[model samples]
Target: MAITSANQLELLQTAEAVAREKMIDPGLVIEAMEESLARAAKSRYGAEMDIRVSIDRKTGRATFSRVRTVVEDEELENYQSELTVAQAKQYLDNPSIGDTIVDEVPPVELGRIAAQSAKQVILQKVREAERERQYEEFKDRAGTIINGQVKREEYGNIIVDIGRGEAVLRRNEKIGRESYRPNDRIRVYIKDVRREPRGPQIFLSRTAPEFMAELFKMEVPEIYDGIIEIKAVARDPGSRAKIAVISYDSSIDPVGACVGMRGSRVQAVVNELQGEKIDIIPWNEDQPTFLVNALQPAEVSKVVLDEEAERIEVVVPDDQLSLAIGRRGQNVRLASQLTGLDIDIMTEAQESERRQKEFAERTTLFMEALDLDEFFAQLLVSEGFSNLEEVAYVELDELLVIDGVDEDTANELQARARDFIEAVNKQALDKARELGVEDSLVEFDGLTPQMILALAEDGVKTLEDFATCADWELAGGWTTVDGQRVKDDGVLEKFDMGLEEAQNLVMTARVQLGWVDPSELEADVEDEAPETSEEEEA
Candidate 1:
């Protein structure tokens, strides 16, 4: 066979260039070409014909070697079929008994086959190499944004031409409110990158939460400079987004800074997101306040957070219910995500009805516990004696003032109220001990030995001890303790110590410890003067 033409040299150089560009080994391309040529040759010639194809990297010239089996009869009939041992010796140094003759096939016959096989091999190799490159390029950018041009649409999915490769933006990934056209430039987050036998698959998204965050970074200077940090973000993409933002500096208003003057900064972000509304909520350590902020534009009357249930019951005016919940529950939904709470929205009317029902249930429990009838309970309720505390504290004259209550009934009611109050106080003291309320005693008119013992274990040895503890400390500590550590002054602060209660406790403790006289302690307590005067008269 003669030397190949210039076209053959160009082909080999092109293959080498492609291999380098795709970061594939040149030897691999040559090997693939050889395999393809072997398959092609076997189909073209007889299977008995031994064939080998080699490519010269420097010149791009291809050569094919043909060897035939040395047979006794040479029954196989083909161009390069069989050869005798003596006939093979002409091309071999020392021909063995079964040695086949080796000869170079003419370039003309093998050129067409080699060229076709090389073309298919190079195309396949280039594709596989490109896939590997794409996988490597996108793996690091899994959670980041990428800008690309819309390439084409197939089966409701948009193919994006990212600089290095193509990415598929599935229908679900598209922001529901917007449309895109071919050649349209858009920014999308690289949701995931996966490898497949066909090629590397790049999944793109426009509705991801990070997309809103990235848009903010692009539009808001404060966010870019780290003056304001977006603590968390939640979005009902194409509709609204709630971003919990906090500012490092006190002077910087995180919500206003994110919103910018006249809504310019957020408007830019909104425009980028195709007019998606954004709620820049000031992130608060207080879950209730944060939730209130998260459900913005709707004034919240109260937010009752149930930490144990991870749920929040939000109370708003009846008129603000729709606004708080937003269209199709977008506001509450975003609030739930931002605050990590299952938010339940309630109107003022609904809340009022609920409170009424709760009050009725509580009243029923109170009456049943005291073995009282509804008439007596209603009479007590009319006197503003809803519970044992009110019943114990209210005067007999106050009870008689209520409708349907005579002086005799008032006296009986007072006695009953006193008894009910003492019993409940004893129960509460026991519960406080079980809850590990330290140095906390609850003193009513009368208490039992069991109640005193429980109070002592709770760290409340006497009325002096009870008066020394803050109300909040008592409430908070009792709520959290599971018969574990006892509450102390240090623990009171952790339980949100109230200043007024703490002051009162200090005064009481000073009097009880004899650091200050009872007269001094009662100096500011108006109600105690009458009690002291009565005790002196007795």
Candidate 2:
């Protein structure tokens, strides 16, 4: 094919048609055509020549040119593409060493092989443009729902034709036992859109928790209008799910709005999810109260929460144990996910047994440590005195409230408790020193002798070592691994050290060692402090 007057406009017509089909910009196709023509021109006009081609966007006229650059005599390497300033005097009044001289050249006629190569180049460029267009179109659409048709099945995965591009619904992303044939309409959540070597990979999902929340937003007018918000969602997918919702307006009920007048809205969502049952609970700011709501259909006797550990214990009647835990522990698992806490469900009988065991253990410790009889130890335990430290430091009035205990008896109890604690502390300090613990760490405030011994045993023997430790390292914390929370033990965790206390103690040690400026610490604290409004301040 030859670039002549006969088909000059045909080039642009072809570009427009291809761009329309690919849903890409027509300018990109025209740019691809120019490069293909230039490549073919170079093959005929000598490969070493600087051949360039430009197509007029309006008239679609192709112009070919050969460019040569003026270089210094010593730097000129290619004679066909380079010219010296002295050699360029004939064509110009003055030419600099970096100036270019362009000469109009006749366009090359495309032979059979050259035309085929040019077509391939245009096709490759068009494909790249199409991929880029797809990526740009769907990048921001992630975390949204889209309706598409099943194109085909690759192994167990579903390839969906999502308007401008194809998306992949992985086998694991589908609801349990979900099967689809070609041309089946499906609604999916746009889980992710990633740019790869082949193209933009749009991954779709039918089992995401966000999918249910979005469905409610689509069905409930209140949710769409921002009167209600979906706080959390946990789904078992194709089985059962739970959603916590909150309403901004006191007159509007979030749960009722989602449920509809007679369960129309929730039923619609249930049909889409293949009959998965859903429990819509009202959201509460208090975690324990929220957890009680999350574990529905079961009566809870009491709730115990450990804020630092992100764990909770729920006591239910023995008959409701199976209901609270659900079949295969699904109810508790979903509740845990919704509340972001690890839940331990026990019957009321079990809780009482555990309490009795703890009481017995505390009573025995007091009896052995303070040289008291069983009855006296039990009485102290019954009075809510759990440990020697509380007994040693408690005021006389507190002990005086106990039956058969006067001021003299209270004084005697404190002396015995203090003496026992001092002996234990001295033993621990001596053990820590035997383990090569430095005096700098031993004299550090806020750490007990037992804490020092624990740190010494863990190879943290110096103040520098303690200062270098992370807050989580001093106070045990939970880590999420493989979608499950795992506990990380801390050396000082046994002393009930919280992360804030650990951070403060570490900062104090750093200040004492001159590793950190106290002024900077104070500035950081001030920066973190919340500002009060003028009205509140007044």
Best by TM-score: 2
* Model 2 Cα lDDT, one tens digit per residue, 1-538: 8999889999989999999999999999998888898889889988888888999998889999999999999998998899899998877799998899999999889999999998999999999988888889999999999999999999899999999989999999999999999999999999999897783389999999999999999999999999999999999999999999999999998889899989999999999999999999999999989999999988899999999878899999999999999999999999999999999999989989999999999999999999999999999999899899999999889999998999999999999999999999999999999999999999999999999999999999999999999999999898989877889998888888998899999999999999999999899989999999999989
Clashes in model 2: which pairs? none
Residue lDDT tens for model 1, 1-538: 1235756676566667777876666677666666566656665665667777777777767777886776554554554667666776677877655666657875544467555775687678667767887898788988888899998888788899998789999888888846778999988998888888873389988888887888788777888899989899998778888888899999989888888889898898888787888878889999998888888899999889777446689999989999998888778878887887778889989999987786677568558765678776655555455566566567767767777778887677667767876776678666666665544234333234344455465566656765565655443432326522333343344334445555566556556567678875466576655565766778
Q: Going through the candidates in order, what is the number of backbone clashes in each?
A: 1, 0
Q: Model 1 off-target regions past 4 Å?
A: 1-8, 17-31, 41-56, 61-118, 365-370, 375-538
Q: What TM-score would candidate 2 get against the native?
A: 0.92
What global local distance difference test value does model 1 have? 0.73
Tell me each candidate's RMSD, in Å, in order: 19.5, 2.7
Task: Report the C-alpha displacement of residue 24, candidate 2, in angstroms.
Answer: 1.4
Q: How accurate locally is residue 160 in candidate 1, as Cα lDDT from 0 to 100?
A: 92
